[model samples]
Structure formats: structure tokens, C-alpha cells
Target chain A: MEVAEKTWGLMKKKVLVIEDNADHQAIIKSSLVSRNYLVVCADNPSDALHYLLDEKIDLIILDLWLPEMDGLSFLKDLKNVPEFSEIPVIVTSGTFGSEYDILKLNGYGVREFFMKPYDPAELVETVGSLLKKTVD
Target chain B: MFYYTDPKRGRDMKRQKRVFLIGLLAAILGYLWELYLIHSHPPFIFVKIKPTWWMQWVILFAAWRIGVFISGLWKTQPTASSQKENDREEELKYLSRIYQDLSNSLRLEKGKFEAVLRGAPDGIFTLDEVGRINFWNESMEKLTELKKEDVLGKPYEDVLTFYSTGKLVGFEQGTMEGSSSSEPRQAVNFFSFNGDQSLSFLEIDAEVSGGKEFPAAVSVSTLKSPDKKNTEQIIITVKDMTAQKEIEKLREEMIAMITHDLRSPLSSILGYAGLLQNPKLCVSEEDRQKFLTALIRSGKGMLLLINNLLETARLGDGKVPVISEPVKIKMVLEEVAENLLALAKGKNLSLSVEAKDNLWADSDKDKLHEILTNLVSNAIKFSRSGEAVKITAFEKAQEVVISISDSGPGIRAEEKEYLFEKFSKIKKQGSTTGLGLYIVKKLTDKINGRIVVESQEAIGSTFTLKLPASKKASSSVQLSLVGSR
Candidate 1:
């Protein structure tokens, strides 16, 4: 049996929030900040692509609708890359049509989805829970 | 006709000639009668010598001159012919202008009506009681992709069958099937169809009347223009609410996405936070417990958020069903109190439920339990340490009122409007999930109950839940049905 490697130090997990709406971005930021997580905001898919290339993103908060390229395609493109393929993307959308779009995103290995008017407390708790589950 | 310069205007000259002939004849006849009297009688008896016809004619002409002088009756019409022609022309012009003005306004009104009908988004069609399509609008033509030639005068059922499949589908079954011989009105039915071209859903509401049926689904409401109660024809207005539906769809998607996305990384954060709570990690005992407590708090908060999202969705779609059955309220209350005891203990609040035996209600067990749990938990959460959380059950004539009152600072008058609204909580100096009261009210309403609030902001708030006398009536109905069977 291969011996399992263990690390003693706590690694800060980086969160990439790809949302088109500015208000929604603010909500994600405030909740993640309260939980003491490093959150990065990208308002469009192009910016998200640039961030993914430059930064080692641990998880993603992706909105399904974005200008030019949407979050679903962004998720698919990132997943296609060997190094970034394993990153979990949580899809968020404000419309029902976009929700149906998220179902397609799920096939791309999205972890979960958050609808807007989301509770700030729930956002914090869910993020904590998702991160905790990953570590375990 | 009298000779006049303009012969068409000879009408005035003819009238003057008729009057002159009558005057001359009358004067000549009067003179002849005087001459006969003089020849027939003696000198003393006979009338004095009377003027001849020519003398009388002179007198009549003098009288005519005097009338013309006083009233100017014979003023020139530029010769009477021109006057008559001018008057006739003016009258004809007035009549023509009135006719033109009326026709123009009528045309404008018709054009306005046609414009409105064409521009309206809802497909409007008129159907007879026998289900014949009599009138179809431009919008209706576009909506069904059928031209007026194809649909007008065809039976609606035939159209529905042709569109749906080869079989006849009894399109009017819901509305027409339920008439008792004496049942006054046909029941209205609302139906929805998703078009094949795109998945756009069309809602149809139809009504039947006086054998002249008018059914349109957009509003699903009877048209208000013609009073079905009095008028022969039923006019229905179909309002296209596609924009409204789109907005609602957008809202639903937003909620779903936000909730889903928040859960992903939140799980990771919570997982790491929980790891610190392990004593094996060499963390201090106090630190371990603190992290664990924080983890639990965050988990609860997240659950509360998710519950709010779900509740909002359910409320909008009207999908919440009230499943009521005979269940003991006392048992439910006891169970709620037991579950809440631990939370109450933490605050040192005396949580107790007061109920009488044999108190039963026919209600959805799950919903009742939820109502009780929310009230009890809210009472314990809001109360100060050592305060009391009381649950009391009593009966009114048709309902049983269950009240949960806490001694914590109650709701204020200003906050009362939003007390049961989603995410609304009393501003307390502590951690709280404002969804409990909202769930309480919503669940209560589902079970056909009312919630009354009694509160003084500084003292505390009391929530009284009223449930119907469902047990007796529902049980009897079930028994009667079984007996009939």
C-alpha cells in the first residue's frame, strides 16, 4: 500500500467568484469575508479565464449568465485544462432559463448552485461546509 | 312657372305670382257681387254705386305697396331667382358638412379599435357555445400559425384535435362535463399549453354563456365588457402576461443559482473549521469546543438560508398542499417541547407546554409540528436567560387556539408589518435566523388557521395560532362516505 502524505500546515483555500451582477458579487464578498476566506471576484468570463491562468484557484462561484462568454462555458473550458480540471465550480443564476443552463453545467462537474436573494449567513455556512467536506 | 332671369330660381317668382292671382280674383269677385246687388234692388234699398273691378284692383295694389313699405316684403333677391338659388346652396352645404364630420369621427373610432386589437399581444378568439370559432384576431392567427381562412367557422374541438393529434381530445370536457340539470352556470376552467416552436407556455381561461361561448386563457377571467348576467354576448379580454412570466422565471433562476453556488466552497470552509475542533489536532480544549460551536452555528445559519429560499419558491408556485388528518395537538406540542428543551436549557428558560387531554384536530401533522416548533424555538431564542417560554392550548367555538408567549422583548409596532415576512427578525442583540416566524405564519395559513400577535416591544411577544375544528367534521364526513359505500 502507498503511504498517505500528510501536511501539518493549514493551506489557505482561494475562491474565484465569477458573477456578472455587481450586487451579487458584493453579497458573495461580504459573506466570504465574514468567514475569513480569500475571495476573488470576476464580473465576466474573460476576466475569469485570465484569473484561472494566473492564480491557483481552489473553488469557483460562477454565475451562469455573463457578457460574451457565459459562466457555464467558462466552467467547461477550465475543466478541460489538465491542471484546473478538478476545481469544483458552484453555479449561480437569477433566472429559470439560466437554471436549466446550470443543469448542463452540472455535467461539467459543478459541486452546487446558489440562487440569488441567497441568505448571507447560508452562503457563509455553505462555503464553510463545502470546504470542510473537501478537507475531510 | 313665372318668368325669372335664372329659371332655377323661378321658385320664388312662382310663389309671388300665386299670391297676386289670388288677390286679383278676390277683388274682382267682390266688385261683381256689388254690381248685381245694385241692378236687382230699388234705388233706396240698393247699395251705393260700387267701384268696378279695375277700381278694386287699384285699391288692392295700394294695399300691397303699403305692406311692402312697412315690412320690405318685396326686396330684390338680385331678382328672387338668385336669392332662392343661394339659400338652397347654403342649406345643402350645411347638410353635407354635418354628414362628412360624422363619417370622419366614425372612421377614426373604427381605426383606433382595429389598431388596439392588432397590437394586443394576447391571441383573442371568439367561440360559440357549440365550440365553433366565429372570430379570430390577428394575434390569434399568428399564435396558432393559422390564417383566418383556415380557422374561421371551424369547430374549436376540431382545431384542437388537428393540432394535438389525429384523435378527438374532448377539449371542452372540463367546463362542459359538470352541469346538473338545475346547475345554473358552467364552471370556468383554466388550461395551459406549451407551443411546439418554443417552450413558451400559453394559459387559457374559458367561460360559457347563453350558448354564445367566449373563452380566452390569458386572464382566465370572464371578460368584463358584456355582463354575462344581463347581456347576450360575453366579451372576454385576454391579456398577454409573457413579460411578467419572464420576470418571475428570472427571479427563480437567480435564487437557485445563488443558493447552489454558495454551498460549494462553504462546504470546504466548514470542513476545515471542523477539523480544528478535533482534540487530536493538539488544539486547546476551549479552542476546540469554540470552533465546533462556530461550525454548528454556521451550519444552522446555512440551513436557515436554504429554508428561506425554498419557502419563497413554494409560496410563489402555490404548490403547498394542506394534508390534514385527525391528530392530537397535545401529543404534537409535547414532542415539540421535548425537542426544544435542550435549547431552552442553554438559556435557562423554563419551557413548558400546557394542554388538555382529548384535544384533537384534523390537520397536516407535519405542518402543525412545524408551526409548534417554530413558535417554541422562537420563544426560547428571544427570551433572556431565566425567562419563561409558555405554550398554552385552549378552545374557542370552531377552533382551538394555541399560544406561545415569551418574556423576551416582544415585537414593536413598526416591525409588526414585516414580522412574518421572510428574513425579518426582531432586532435583538444576538444571533438569530429570522425565518422561524415566517414559517410559522405560512404553515398556519396552509392549515386554514389564523395567527394573532400580542406584544409590547419592551415586554415580550405572544403568538396565538388558531386551528379549525377539523376533527369532528372530517371524521363524520369520512364515516358517511364509508357508510354510503
Candidate 2:
């Protein structure tokens, strides 16, 4: 009776994907959706920021190379805002970045980094762990 | 002649003649004055001696000797002057011979240079500093299909008269309309480099004769004067790299296709494995078999792709040997038809074979099977639903011909040239790698066979392969005919 009350009351958290590739976005969407996590997609940082403003986003999955703005700038701007600062961002890139860029992104409170073609299973586990930490 | 023609030398000769005349005139005047003075005033009678008969004889002898001495002086003056003139003429003749020799050697050297330039297989054109075509060779003539008279003095940037407005034609200008693999315009930038610059090479896909654009590797080297001090001309060597570039592009495209093709099957295999690994999922024995079967089909598709790739690599080195033994062509066609039945059924295609009894040819058994399989498979892949593909084999003289006819949309007339070329992609929707016909052509060459394709758009295509008949098969057939008679 207690489990039913808790499950029915709280809705699934929304995760926004900032990816440009159609196949990668589809794969991310299907994987997350199959795991019962609400997913949203955007091709760039600016559109993803709009999602963060309109919807109650629990976490952000970011890609570095974007049309309008990059993931680093988005992270910097999001952190400056008092309301969106708490949401953790995960950086995923097709291009393997240098050590300095990874260290710098980590200092920005990024939860984790994944290089593409990443294992979909590991991605799910990481997302689950980060969300669990956020709830706690 | 030179002394007369030259004003300076003529003036000296005239001055010398005038001096000689004045000396002669003075001597005559002095002689006449002496005669007049002696006649007017006679010498003292005591000092003057009267002439006798013996005195007359001595005077005569002295006169004769003096005459001889004067004649000798005259002869020496004339002979010395004539000798000097003769020496001058000989010197002039020697100089003229040297001049002739130098000119002949220069002409021979020029001929040798011209021959070397024209002998080059690549287009060699020497451009002046101002971009004028100072020298054009025979290869350039062939490459541009422009005659020497037309292009020798023309400018590098030509304005074609084809367009009424006189559109300018530049070599290998860059635009985004080219293929995705097009490089930046750095190669042609060598032409625009500043004065007396270091040598550079610029390769481009130039539109040559007949508006056909082919890739060419151009190297620009500055031709300096004989002393190597000043830049004389720019020598541009244009090597037509069309064939090499085509192979490279095909290789890249094939790689991309292989990656994409491999990914689809890999995705299926991964999905199946993921499902099987799931502890929450339950599977039936029948479902397992179906999954296994799907995996096997995907694996076979990958295997066929790998096989085609291996064949391409093998054929690239040299021709593989063919076993010249008697083999029945009918069996090969039947085998190909049997294999393509499932594929034809999927597309609802009618596949049929017409062959003479035991129609044999001297060819490799396995290679013949492979050739039939490729042709029949291609036919089925291209044919629409309910359309029929026919395989027919016959014998004419010492050759055996097997023709595969398809009801697919046939190849266009223009596309036939590239049909057997490596990496040629005529159809967009091909299941196999695009090197099918190229490999078939190579294999046919191994058995000294010939292959030809006859097609009309919307009508269909017929591919024919002809190989020499084995002697044994012909002799056996002749023996059977005699026995029947």
C-alpha cells in the first residue's frame, strides 16, 4: 500500500538529449524510453536550453559540437543561473577530447563522460546512478 | 666589298688615293720646273762636259738598270696590295663558315628539344611570365583536342566562343557542385603566386576536350635562363590521373557502403544477443531457431560481401589462372538458377534457362559457376515483380556462348562505357558491391573469353559470355553425329 502510494504520486524524471545525429538520438530515445525514463531531444545547446526552461529537466545529456552553441558554453551559462545549477550534465562526444578538456568539464560538475559509440547498457546504468544520487 | 659598303673605310680609301695623286702631281710639276730652268739658264761651259760615243754607251746601260729597278718597285706595291686583299677575302670566307656551323648546331639542338617535349606522354606547355602559351607540345594538343596553331599563342584564361556572351574557361575552377570528396582550391593557387616564387604543384580535375572533366596532377616548375639567373618560363606538366582517381574514389565509396551494410546486420545480431542475454525475457525452442536462422542469414550476407572484397583485392594484382578442361555450361546455369530461386521468389521474378544437351566449353568449372551466379543474381535483383529472366546457352563454331537476359530497366547507351569499369555504380539500389562486372570481366580474360552487354532503356539487358570450346567436346560431338548418320 505504501509502495503504490509513492509510485503513483511521483512522476518519471525528464532527461534532455543534446545530440545532432538522427541515428544516435533515436537510439538514445528508444533506450531511455524502454527503461521508463521520459526523454526529450534537441540538435543543439540553445534548443536544449529552451527545453530546460519550459520543462522540469532532471538531467542533461550534452554533445560538444553543435550548430548554434557548444556544450561547454551551455554548461557555463546553465551553472551561472541559480535555478538550473543543480541539474547534472553528462557529456558525450563522438570526437575523443584531450585530457585538459575532460578535466575542465569535470570541474564544471559534469556527472560523467561517454565516448560514442558507447554501450547503451552502461549509459543506462550511469543515468540511473546519477539520478539516484540526485534523489538522495 | 666591305670597304666600299662601309662609309668609314670608304672615306679612308678615298683620302689615301688623293694623297697619292698629290705626290704624283708635285713630282710632275718639279720635273717641268727643272726642265724650264735648265733651258733658260745654261751651266758654265767649263763644268759641263760634251757627250762622246763611249759616254752614250755608259748612259744607256745605267738607264736600262734603272728601268728594271722601277719596274720591280711597281710590281712589289701591286703584289703587296693584292696579297692583303686576298687575305681579307680568306678571313671573310672562314668567318662565314663558322657562322653556318653555329647556326646548324643551334637548329639541331632546337630540334632535339622539340622532340623531347613532344615525346612526353603528359601535356607539357611552357607559359610565359605573362600567362601566354609560349610553347605547347603534341600531348597538350591531344589532351585539349586543340590544334597547335590555335593554342600556341593563346592566353591561359581562354574565353570560349561557344557561349554567345563569351564565357571564360579556366582550368579546374573550384565549386561546391563537385563530389563530396573534392579538395580545397590550394592546387591551382600555384598559378597565382607572386613573382619569382618557389616552385609549386597544383593538381585539379580539369575539363579537357569535349567538356569531359578528368582529374590531372599538375606540377609547375620555373624554367630559368641558361645561366640560371632569371626565371624564363613556367613549365607545367599535366599528368592525367583520371584512372587512378576513379579507383581511389571507388575504394572510398565501397568502404562506406561496406560499413553501412555491415552495420545493419550487426545491429540485428546485437539486438538478438541483447534479448537472449536478458534475464527477464523468456524464449521458446522455435523462437530460438528463428533467431539463429536470422543470424545465419545475416552472417551469410556479410560473408558474400567479404568474398566480393577478396575477389577485388585478388584481381587487382594479376589474372588468376583458369583450368582449360571440358565442362558443361548447362550445369553451371542450373546451379545459379537454383541458388537465385529464393531471391527471385522474394521479388516474384520468373527465372528460366534454355540450353543444349551437354553443351560444354573449355573453361574453369568454378569460375564459370561464379560468372553465372553473378549474372543471374543481378538479373533477379533488378527485375520487377512477375518479370522473367532468361539464361540461354548455344554453340557456334569453336566457341560456346552463354547469355543471361533480364527484364529489368536496361542500361542507357551512355552508361555502357563504364559498365565494366571498376567501382562503376550504374544503379543506386544494388545489393552487392559495385565491382561485380569488373570482376566478371577480369575472370573472363583469364579463360581468353569475351563478354558483351546489349541493352536498351526500359526494354531489358542481355549479358553474353563466349569461351573457346574444348577440342575433346567437339571431337566427341562430331563422332556422335557420324555414328547417327
Candidate 3:
């Protein structure tokens, strides 16, 4: 799952990936960080909440399943805190079905939903496009 | 001369016969007396027939005296003393009837007792207070392979001698291990009886015909007299418990097999998953594919093993229940919170819950309960002294989020590779089967929800689940007070 479309614009984009699986987290970080996009990681949402406060996070990548709190609920909880609502969350999960559509998640204030064993390239491209829009 | 028989017929016949003889004598007496009177002193003057006539007079006088005795006897009735004699005989008959009834019931009871003992399926025998084998049942005869005639009425230990480890069963030489079982360890030894635990071996008259030994559960009980007045006998019942012992052995064998089989596959999956998750390893695409394929295969194998060890239904049935009802999410969380508080307190941990007043989730109550319970229990398992575990839930836009946070030795970032994988071990987790998290994940997937983990080393960990909130229960639905009841 590597991205063929690598960005040439050398701007440091800071992102926090709230994920529990180390391998998937490693794969996501490796695929994104190599392209000059700095990734901050938290194993759960509560820690994700910390990085949101401490850093200038451009975007957030959240795993749907986590130990401390689920991604959607954390999204909902994060939305209640006015400042975190401005941050767009890219939800990634190992689970799928009709109930897990990206549009359906958008209704929960999620910007995107990625199914795992996901293509790391597509994720990077999607992150690039969203970050570009926010920067503009 | 006639006998006066008991019946009145014999007495009348004898009386009539004697009267007829008397009548004949009277006629002769009338004529003879006239002649004798003429001879003695003539009616007008002395008419002498001679001195021989004197003998005739003596015979006549003797007949008259016997007749007077018979007449007197005919006038008397049965005496009062004789009536008393009849009454005495009636009393004797009534006494005999009562004696018959008492003796008959006693005999019947004795017959029943003997029959029960004789027909018993298990070996049974009775010993007198002195330990003499007075009674032996049919089963005992069959068990010993000796006829009742041979063993009964003889000293039990001598007649039906059995040796276990070359020591007598009832009279063990010195309570040796291999010898006959020890005497009752309970208070029964204080009395003459042996408690049911005193088991022994009974070999057929092994001296005469060598026979295999069968273990017998022996119960020696004191038999009371029929009136329950006194104890004079001891009865022993022996049941062959060989089948029960065999079943117990089989169960131990099954447990051994489960441990050996389940552990190997678990470690196999853990090792393979660990290897596959390494991102920096330089390898050919084919090799990576091979390892990935092996990892999946081994992972399935581990799942099959665990599925067999525990209930296999949890995986299959978990996905099928779409029972979408507006369940009060706070009620379940509160119930789980109250229940696990004691467990947390046992380790000096504080467990608390925070939830909105009437938040509801569109989900199956049972599945959600299982999911919540597994998460909460896992929290307590990894927690230690003075750690506080918190459960918080709230409805966020279109979904309700529940979180169980535990101040425990949290997972390392590296080991998180397979945190929720089936049979994966967590840091500092002692020997648990590790099926809890895997099941929890599956249940979350089934309910169309998702779980997330947040942890830091030495800080703590929290597991949160986001389930869709039921629109029908929008707001203002009050869940009944659920905890501290």
C-alpha cells in the first residue's frame, strides 16, 4: 500500500495518528513520514487529546477501534470541545460494511474513513489533499 | 359296670340298663320275701321253708342298698365349680389366639428382613456383637464365590478370609498403606461402626481358588434390636465403586490434553504475527507473502483451538444477533460499574462510572453486556494497588461513546502490534487464556461499533467503544436507578 503520487512541495505538515495496532501504526507512519509529513502518534483518544493540545496538528488519523475510547465517540467528544472540532479526523478501521461508509462517517464530523489492510499510498494522497485545502 | 362318659347319651344308656336289671330283681324280691316271711314267721302262724332261706334274704338286702345309691345320684345337677372350669378353658383359648397373632407378625417381619439382605445387589453380611458371621446375603455368597453354608456361623475373618497386600481386610495388621483400608477416621471409630469412607478389597476365597480383587466401599453400621431398644449386631454393606473411579481418571486425562494442545497453537500464532508486523525487515515480496500467508493460517489454527477449549458458539452467535432496540446504555454501564467495584476494591483500586442521565444505544442488550463486562474485567486484571479505574459514557452527536480507563501497567507501544489478536499476551499478564479482548473486538464489530485504546507506560490505559445512538430514544428517556441496590 505505497503511494506512487509523492508531493514535491516541501512544507512540513504535522499530523497525529491515534491508533492501537503497532504494525498498522508503523506502516501508516512509515508511509506518511517518509514524504516529509511529520506524524504524532497516540495509542488511544485520551492521549490523542494530549497531542491535540500540545502540538500544531494539521490533521488527525484515528483508528476506529481503540482501548481508551472508540474513534467515532472520541470524534463526538472531541467535537464538543470547540477547538478540536476544527481538526478533520481520517477514521481508519479493520472493520467494514454498509454502516461504515465515508459519507456516513462525515455525518459524525469525520472527513474520511479508510478500511484497513488499507493502501498507505491512497491514505497519504488523501491526507495531502485535505491538508492542502486547510492550508489554502 | 359302665363308664360315665362325658356325653349324656352314655350315662342314660347305662342308667336304663341298670333300671331294667333292678326291675327283674324287685319282682323276684316280692315273691321271695313272701316265701321268706312265711318261713320266718308264718303270716298267721310260723310256716318254715328251712334255714337255707337265710342266704336268699342277704342277697335281697344287698340289691336294695345299691338301688338307693343310684336314685340319689340321679337327683343332683352340674356343680358351680364345674361352670368355673368351663370359663377357665375359654380364657386359655383367647390367650392362645393373641399369642398366635403376635408370633405371626414377628415371624413375617423377620422373613422380610432376611429377604431384603439376601436379595440386595451389593454384598452384605451381618456379624454378631463378637464379630461372628451369623448371616450372609446371596450377593455376599456370589462375591466370595463361596456357598453361604461354608461362611456363615463362623468367624468372619477366618471363614471368608481376604488379604489386601497380605493383610486381612477387616483386621489390618498395622494399618499399612497397601494393606486393607484404615479404620474409619471419623467419630465412627469411637463406636463399633466404620464410617462409609472405610473401603476395602474383597478377593474371592483366594486361598482355595485365586480370584482377582475388586474394591468395595464398606459401611459398617450397628443394627439395633427390633424394638430399637438395644444394639446387638453389626451389618456391613459393600458397594463396588470401580466404575466411578474410572470416570474420575478419564476427566484428569482430558484436562491434561487441553493444556498441552491449546498452549502450542497460541504461541505459534503470537510468534508469526510478531514477525509479520516488522516493517523495516528487508525481504522479497514472495517471502513477505509466504510469511503473511503462514501468519494467517497459524492465526486461524489458534482461533480453532480456543474455540474448541471454550464455547465455540461465542464467535458464530455473536455476529447473528441484530437485536437493535433502544437499550439504556447508562444502565448497563452503571450495573457493570457497581458489580466490578468490589473486585477493584479487593486490589485497593478505585472503580467509578460517569454517564449522562438517560443516554441510550441502538444495540443488543446481551451482546453489549458481554462486551462491557469483558472490557471492565480486563481493566481490573491488569490493575494494581491504589490505581483508579474510571468508566465514562456520553452521547456524541449520532453515537454513544463508553470508556473504561484503568490505571494499570499499560501496554508498550511495540507490543501493541497484536494487542487484540486472539491468544495474544499482554505485558505483565499472568497465565490467562487471553480470549477476552479478541471476543470483545468481535462483539464490537457485530454491533456495528468500534473500540479504541489509549495508554502510556506507568500512567494507565483506557478502552472506549462508540456505538450508534438510537434516534427513537432521542432524549428525556430515564433509565431506572441501577447501582448500590
RMSD per model, one decimal: 20.6, 14.0, 25.2
Model 1, residue B35: C-alpha shift (Å): 12
Candidate 2: docking tier: incorrect
TM-score of every candidate relative to the true structure:
0.37, 0.48, 0.31
Span of ten consecutive residues with least summed lDDT in model 2 chain B: B159-168
Candidate 2 to truth, TM: 0.48
The whole-model lDDT of each prediction reads 0.61, 0.68, 0.65
Cα interface RMSD of each candidate = 12.6, 7.6, 9.8
**For model 1, what is the error of residue B156's alpha carbon versus the real structure, in angstroms, after optimal superposition?**
58
Better of 2 and 3 by lDDT: 2
Residue-level lDDT tens digits of model 1 in A1-136? 2233332333667899987543456446645654667889986777887888899887888876566675666777888899888776677664435445655666787757766445556666666677777777
Off by over 4 Å in 3: A1-136, B1-88, B159-191, B194-210, B224-231, B270-299, B302-485
Q: For residues A1-136, what per-residue lDDT tens digits would candidate 3 score against the true structure?
A: 1343333353588989887654456556766765677988887777888888898888899876576555778877887888878887788765443553555577777757775555566687799898878867
